[model samples]
Target: MRREQVLVFDADDTLWENNVVFERVIAQFLGWLDHPALGLPERRAVLDEIQAANAVTHGYGSGMLIRSFADCATRLRGRPVTAAETAEIAALAAVLIDHQVELVPGAADTLARLGVRHRLLLLTKGDAEEQRRKIDASGLAPYFQALEIVPEKDDAAYRRLITAYGLDPAESWMIGNSPKSDILPARRAGMNAVFIPHAHTWVLEHGEVDASDPGVLHLGALTELVDHF
Candidate 1:
């Protein structure tokens, strides 16, 4: 049997619905933005491109997403956006603020089962308030021994978590869907990692993973953790 160890989890796509909600809101915005010349795919490309540039400066969350929508519409229309259009775009995100947190299938049960033997820590990065709000809503917060919300989950962030938690890098594992934020960085910090790819993972979090990586394990779903750990 494996030894009891620290398990760090990414909260957004890993635990509950996040980017999917944004995608739904964006779809609604796009429907409203039906352009005379551009097709749906072309319109989506414009928004995606604008978000790639704006995400670095604006950071993340619904507010930044709304900004990207406005910027996209402005660029598409070739004119400064009116207050009405901005308000309509803002309403899309406003509805997003109230979207209920939907946990991944068996997430709560898996956390409960694992918590009995291992320490579980939630290590999600995003707007602090937004992250916390989701945490509060998920009802899975009780499973975590502690939670750390940050702007980004980089290698340094992983290293810092180790220092703060007094975790043994070899004994610890990071669990989540995103390879960029969860798997690779944890491996770099000398911890083992489990990659469970999500279908609708944010474009920014995509990263290639090698199947032969020494300590990285890939799983089909969250419930499968029960058998492994």
Candidate 2:
């Protein structure tokens, strides 16, 4: 019989086009600002700063992003934001929240194939409701034996998952795009990790990774995983 390995997958960027949607929405928000003094780069910097601040208090999701956009617009305009402007911002949030969850190439095929031989689990971090909505819409939900949406992805979180599922560190593997959240934490938890880098990774998610780590494996694409395992 094939070994019963516990395979954990990250939902965002790892399995679908997540950060790309956020980037597009940021562009739309900047267009709405239309500040002569603030160029695209400056506006992006301002938004990132505000978003980071809001993330600490409000956590992560479209709701936090919308609030940050409103705050940034108000700061740039040097005046109280009008009700109409707020309405437009709300519309933008709607578009972002309702955007279709597009799967990464080969994600579905790989998950389907792996499901037959391994215990598949989706480990994602974000707003609970938003993450659930995206997972429900992705159409890839059936393949996972469980779905975990957390406030943060850290070593402690991975340890809890390992304990909760009664998973053996030697037989468990975590696969994702973010080194800080997915790869490093899994390795720290004594589980193997597969790093599949994404082009549009969020700046906050970037971190220094030691390629020499024996427990970490790097793949150029999601399809490559099928051949590796």
Q: With candidate 2 superimposed using the best TM-score fit, by how many Å does residue 137's alpha carbon deviate from the native?
A: 1.2
All candidates' lDDT scores?
0.89, 0.90
Error of 2 at 106 (Å): 1.6
Which regions of candidate 2 fall more than 4 Å away from where they truly are? none
Deviation from truth (RMSD, Å), model 1: 1.3
lDDT of 2 by residue, 149-227 (tens): 9998999999999999999999899999999889988998999999999999987788877989888889999889777
Candidate 1: worst 10 consecutive residues by lDDT? Answer: 54-63
Give the Å shift of residue 190 in candidate 1: 1.7
Per-residue CA lDDT of candidate 1, range 1-229, in tens?
Answer: 6689999999888898788888888888889998999988899889988888887888788878888998998899998889999888888789778889999999899999999999999998878898899999999999999999987789999999999999999999999999889998899899999999999998878998879998998999999999899
Give residue 214's error in model 1 in angstroms.
Answer: 2.3
